[model samples]
Target: MIVGTAGHIDHGKTALLEALTGQAGDQRREERERGMTIDLGYRYAALTPGAPLTGFIDVPGHERFIHNMLAGAQGIDLVLLVVAADDGVMPQTREHLAIVELLGIARALVVISKCDRVEPQRVQEVQTQVSVLLAAGPYAGAAPFMVSSVTGEGIEPLRRALLAAQSEVSQRSREGGFRLAIDRAFAVAGAGIVVTGTALDGRVQLGDTLLLGKAGKPVRVRGLHAQNQPATEAHAGQRVALNISAERLQLEQVHRGDWLLAEWLHAPTQRLDIELQLLASELRAFEHFSPVHVHLGTQDVTARVALLQGEQLLPGARMFAQLLTNAPLQAVHGDRLVLRDQRAQRTLGGGRVLDPFAPARQRRSEARLAQLQALASADSLEQALPALLACDDGGLDPQRLERQFNRLRSSWQLPANAQVIATRQGPLLFTREHWQALQNSVLEGLARFHTQEPDQLGPDRDRLRRFVALALERPAFISLVDELLAANRMSSSGPWLHLPEHRIRLSDADALLWSQLQPLLVDGAFDPPWVRDLAKALSVDEAEVRVLLRKLGRLGQVHQVVRDLFYPEATIRQMAAMLLQLASDDPVVQVAAFRDVLGIGRKRSVQILEYFDRIGLTRRVGDRRQIRADNALAQSPGQ
Candidate 1:
């Protein structure tokens, strides 16, 4: 079970956790002298005697470092809210309670610490104040106790209360994808760079390559330790210390905001969607589009809020809003957040993240606002997937999708042809239908180009690339085109592409000229005849003969042997089949015999044989031709 300590500054939070766990939480020298925590500190406790697995997260109580406190509170199972008996329910105490409430922490035991400093009557008065405060927050009706780490007055009762809380806590499983928010980074003498944090989900072993967010750099785990002892693997709900093998990383290079992830997750974005609520005690004069400090998962960003409902919100009222940040942040859906007013620098309220990577939208658009609200309320992946798909404008990045649905990816059951492709700009999600439509459009574009330019073989690759890029305007356009070719819907020759289903239909005059050109192709030469010669021989116009040659080239029915000469499809196919069959029987056939067998001169035979090699029909030995073992002719037709 995992436990968390929460209270205002200098309220004996770290002291109580230390006394209960036998571990000192304050690592920095300043925190020990100042008597206030400035950063998050972690320690472990064993509620059950000789138990193997039990821990607690000791969080800072300072209002300024509440962002650090939030990072520690994300994966906690039980709360040990330490309230001093002398000063009950202070400002930071109320803010921390609001954060826990927004984060959905249900079970808690309120500890009124430092009871020895106050008189008995004063302690009772503080208890009454604490009870009133708890009645209105998430800790309403929770059990309250008094404890003092100095005198050990109520330690036994507090221990019993913690043990009872441990019994009611459930175990956390490590079945999802790994996500470790790095709160501390340092270097060990012998071991390389080391990072310590609590694993949010899934497990990490001693040797696993992990991708850090935004940077996307791969780092290997050299070792793992849990509770100061070497361990093979660390799972969710366990505080972990990892020794990384990256030598170039400095201690200051990695900060409290980076994430160590299992797979490449989403790129950090500057805008987000959230369901915000204002605290009842906050002033109602705060406007709707006010600037505030946004805190989530150890990241603090400055953002302006735009309310989804009325012009201004009343205290204790909930409303949907968008946060436009000043910088990028690494966040995910369902993460809790705290918003503090910028002018006064006081925490206004808190809320849960709905869309951590949303795009900016204009205000006063009712339809889009309603859509965002629906996305926030979606309870399952089935509901969320379709809503995300509808909002995706065809250019959602694959890495972002993997992170957002890492836990539910297996359940999505995307088809084989469906793919998430990444390009230089971003990622795009495509299904079989989208690929088919793209192929059809490319084929039609090629056909149009062939009709207009009779001299060219086909549309060049640049033309096709540009056409698709302009038509789709998606970041994954190049990747999608590559997928289309891999699936055999399109084929490439030289620098041109052709759709497998597109064929060139010929007119009567062109058919006549094609018949005349077929016999002359047997005698391949650099310059055969001009268009006028072909027209004079076939009794047709020169323009018609030119059109015939162009049509044949586009359909792969003919290839330009030289500047003016052309070879017909029938001659090429017959020679290709003979060469394939001969190479299959004799592993080594001389180049001279290959030329003689095809009934063509050396030049044309070499070109046709090289083409066969490229099509995977044959292999080239030392100055000879040999058939590939896995060639199409080597397999039976049924295959």
Candidate 2:
């Protein structure tokens, strides 16, 4: 567990750490000369052998070093909020506590350091002041533990309390991918490049390759050390130091704010959708489009706030907003971060990343804002999804759904029976209610077709597709029909598709016409003539044969390629199969080749080739053609 020290400057933060750990924090020349922490200082304390191992991040208490403190606070499990007994609460003390709250550090042990310098009564007064300040925050009623690093007074009690606070911190899940924000990076004499940060999740093993950034080159881990020990692997919530080979990478290219993780999980983006929280004590409201410095993970970058629902956010107001960053951030969804003024001098507010890789234009829309709000407040992706899919009539885009999971770094398992409707525009999401509505639409359309066209077996698959607004793609429609058929909800015979519950029986006059028409169509075979020839062959009027053939076309028995030209689907399939076979053996089969195979005239073969090209069944190259696919029988758009 990682614990951080936060309070005013020179308030015995370093001294307390040294007393507990029995070593001065980061004994560097600059720190000894200046008598203050210039950058992050790290040291570890073993409270108990059986208890969890603990590490302390002693941050600079001075106001100017707040950014440095944030760098260390990113992965700490809890904070030890320090305040000097003699001085009580000072400017930096308040700022540091506010920062701790902004960073979403819920667990803390408030300590009155330097207790030896003040009287017992003074310590009581200071403790009261600290309690009153924390009254409205997450640590309300958390009693301050008085301690003096100068002597051993209250030292043992503080250690016990720190252990208890650390126990309360829930461990980060050790699943998914690993991400480490590089807080410290430099080159050692002969060990190559060393970078240190807390591993947020998963494990990073020695010799494993990790992507440097989004679309970044791969880097191999030459060696690794976790929790100050030479270890083979590291897991979540542990301080890790990685030794990377410096053959191709430059020192300047490795810096704070860059992230190391699996390539698929690296979604570096500039725009973010957030659920913002403004501090109630701020003097003014959070104005829209106001430039601010976003302290995310270990990196601080300039960004502007875009109020998603309104023009401004009043003090203490919680709302949905967008952060437009000047530089890319490696933050994921649900990562807590603070927002400061553009100059990096004041804390404006803080928020959680909702959509870290959000699109710019879509985020500004009102419809999207509602979805963002629902997702922001959800406890899990499963809880947020239904409302998210309900935002648009069209199903949710896969890319949009990924933002929620990627933002939270969640497991990507989808729920059962997750309804998805494929459309020409894209995949449209459907609720259970909507799926039911679709089933009704199909059954009702078929019933109406039966009522209107009594002589036909069912509606043409193409006609039913149009009647339903053509919302589903052809493939999706066919899949739905197949599913219905498997369930015995629908049935099909030859060219006809129909509900299993419905049937068509021919009338006396229609029966006589069908008997003659069926024979005429069968005798014509592969080279079936037009309606004119059918009427002459059957000794019927041309207009009457044309009307009867149209009825046959509705039954799915015949296919009409052009005006006055019709053939049974069986004949077309036979001709298509032969053409495909010829193209497979030959380089390219032209109309002449197909004419010879079908033993048909030039006009008929040319018409068939042109039809094949239009429907994506064949590709034309100069005077020759080739088969595009082998699915000529499944060419119904309505299917």
Candidate 3:
């Protein structure tokens, strides 16, 4: 089990660890010279001959080095909150306790160090202050003890208390996959790279290949040490140093905050939708898009909070928000994250990650906010999954789900009726009922479109996707469309989708409208009028002209020059051949050359040239254009 020491700088936090473990935590010369820990330090202690070892993470207590402290705070089974008796409770002492509270560390023991410096009454006064502070916060169960590294006072009792707490600390379930949040990394003489941290979730043995992140290079564990002794295997809840083979990997690639994963889950994500808990100490309300520093398991990243439900998050208030980070983080559900000021000076607040891979769109809906709240309240994967899928109607990415919950890969179960949509990104899950609803929605949309035009093919994929209220990623939506076509529930032609029974039909009214609109469009081919202008020329309402032209365009009778402009397909093809021939001959088809070849005025020539570029018939470069025959083939009708 891991025990992290927290207190003010120069307050004997490192000294207390050294005295208990019989080794100095600060191994660096600078740390020894300054007499303070500037980074994370590790030491180990064995309470008895046969008892398991207790590892201590000695974190810097200085306000300037709080970021370093936070890195060592993750995965701590118990907290040894040290306060120097001479100084009582200092600023960093209070801040570190706040951090411990925010991180949700359940077990703690406040040690009033330097009992030798002050008299017995002075030590008693400091203990009272510490106890009073703990009583007011989440760490109220903590008991304070007075100790001195110089005199060894109360040291045995402290060890005994920690051992008792160890018995009560829960064991990490081995049911989940392996993941280690690296807190330290360095190169050794023979070893390529060594990363140290507490193993979480699953077991890893010698020669087991692990991934540094989702997309990181594969790393082979040459060896491992548990509590400073050689060990063939390491599992969740144990502190370990994995000797990574230098022959296979460069030391520079591994860094603190990178995870040594089982290669089953993808690398961490930068964005997360979380339930942010603001500190009551902060006076200013947390505003939307507010810039801050996010500290998670030794990783420090610049991020901004995008409030999901409100414009401002008041102090001490909990709100659902999205944290957009400048760098990626490997995290899962229940990972505690602290938010600090952008300057990295003050702790603004903290929060728990509700969904590491939150939907990037439509997160503000009332249903979504309610779902996030449920997720925040859920204590286990079994309780969270259904609530999550209930709000995310489009579907949840399976890889993201794996990253969000440690129990998901094994014991955590999903709904019996759920189905998977395989996409390039990952598998998306939807309940059978939801999938049926989606299929019905698609069919109804197509039926509606068919009834409106009757002379046109069904709506294209993009148009069909717009009918769904939820915004799904493009690949997942495409996968669903493909599934429907494969199942014979829908039919597809090119990029369009329709029910199998759907077909284009023309009524007498539509035929008359087409007869009136066709000649006018084809005659105005060289300088086709905009839709509104065409309606004016034909002595008809623009809406009527729009309906006729929509049918005409879908029937392959005309080309949409742009949104409002329409031209006959025949006119467009003739122009395409002219442009291609000019580029093929000269290699540089300029506007002047195009104008000369088409024999149209400058304005019409510019419009037509841009139109060709927009339609991918020609590529533009330095006032010139080149046509790639392959990509340009499908863009031009009749090509």
Candidate 4:
């Protein structure tokens, strides 16, 4: 379990954490001298025997470093909201509370620190004020404990409260795609590089290769630890320390905002759709397209906000908005964010991310805004999957879908009876309705091809690709084709593809043409006449001749030579026989001799010889032809 500290500046958040864990959270010399936290700090607490170890993230409480606080808060499983009994709720305290609420932190233990500094009556007064302030926050009804880190008063009660809160703490979603928001990066003498963060989703183990966001660099996990003890694997809600084998990276280079993730899981974007809520106590109103500082996970970015409902947003109003930023962010849907108005220099509101990687836009329609709102409210896979499919302008990539819906895929146990089409080009998600429609389209295409070219085996694969491309604009259409093949609804042979029942056949006219043309191929030197000439000879119309020729070509009963000339299978066989006979008598045969032996003119002779050369029957040597030594005919006797 991961616990995060939140409170106002100089409220002793780090001190309380140190007293609880016996570890100094503040490692910076300046922070120790100045007596204030300027950066994120870390400590660990050993739970009662038989309980899980707990890790704590001590965050800065100063308004200037609230961004750092947000970064630490991103991966915490539970929050420890600290309020000094003397000062009660301060500015940063409220801001931190707002951030925790937006981050969807539901389990918390409110701490009223510095109980020794105030009289009993004053402590009671401060507690009352703190209670009222938290009444509307995430910890509205949470149990508030009084503790003095200096004297360790009420320390055991605080521990008991935290342990009790653990029971109400909801288990992390175990199935989502893996995301690790890096908070601490350092170098180990012999271990190379190491990073530590709370594992947000999925599980990670030793030897797994993870991809760093944006950079796409592959890093191998050499070791893993949980709460200072070496472990083989770590799951969601656990604080994990990963030792990477790559070249050691600088602390600043890795930074707090970077993410270590499963390869190809998500793409970074500079825009997001968010459901925002302004605090009731905020003094100023937010105008449309106002500039603000946006903080999510561990990254701080300047964003221009586009209000969804109106021009001026009043305090405490829930609204949908788009955050457009110049810096790219590595985020996912359902992530939480904090926005601060640039002019007011005060934390304005908090929101949940709807589209983590959305395109930048100035003007959007009501329908689109409604779609974003729907996505924000989606809770289950059934609700979310369809919305994702609908939003995918082109077909989604199956590999991407598998990764994006990782949690859903495992828990939902998607039925195998449902057909999912995957093409080489894209993954097309199909509900039962979409799958049936695709089946109907494919059957119809095959039926049309059969009616138009009955003698042909089926449609050409290229033609089918073109047809599907025209019907489905997204890459997912290819996935549909794969589904058809897997279901045995379709079959492919060479460049041709068809429904299961498709076959090749020749028409009566084509049969007659084959019979008439077969005997003419005796000498292996005949150039069949053009379609018009064949029509005149056979006493048939030009269209009839063309139909017969096309059918013959499809059946492999004839070979087209140039535009109008053709040869039957028998012609090719006879040509091969004559060439074999000539090659048995001499190592080489001149083109003229071969042409004379075949009793053909120079044009037809050159064509036949070229065909032989193409098939490795003979090799061209300048103006002459030589029998290919590797040819099977060389082993046979014929002189």
Q: Which candidate tops TM-score? A: 3
Q: lDDT tens digits, residues 249-348, model 3? A: 6777788888888777655687798889888878899899999999887678999999998899898888889999998887788888999998999998
What would the per-residue lDDT of candidate 1 be over residues 162-200, giving only the tens digit for each residue?
787777776565755777877788888987688877777
The TM-scores of all predictions, comma-separated, are 0.65, 0.71, 0.76, 0.68
Order of quality (lDDT): 3, 2, 4, 1
lDDT of 2 by residue, 320-389 (tens): 8888898888776678899988889888789888877676766667778877877787866677777776
Worst 10 residues of 1 by lDDT: 630-639
- RMSD of each predicted structure: 9.5, 6.7, 7.5, 10.2
Candidate lDDT (C-alpha), each? 0.70, 0.78, 0.80, 0.73
Off by over 4 Å in 3: 24-26, 213-215, 246-253, 406-411, 422-426, 460-463, 466-639
Candidates sorted by TM-score, best first: 3, 2, 4, 1
**Model 3 alpha-carbon miss at residue 115, Å:** 2.7
Question: With candidate 1 superimposed using the best TM-score fit, by how many Å does residue 123's alpha carbon deviate from the native?
Answer: 2.9
User: Which sections of candidate 1 miss by over 4 Å?
Assistant: 285-289, 306-314, 360-371, 379-383, 386-400, 411-639
Better of 1 and 4 by lDDT: 4
Q: Lowest lDDT 10-mer window, candidate 4? A: 630-639
Question: Which candidate number maximizes lDDT?
Answer: 3
How far off is model 1, as Cα RMSD? 9.5
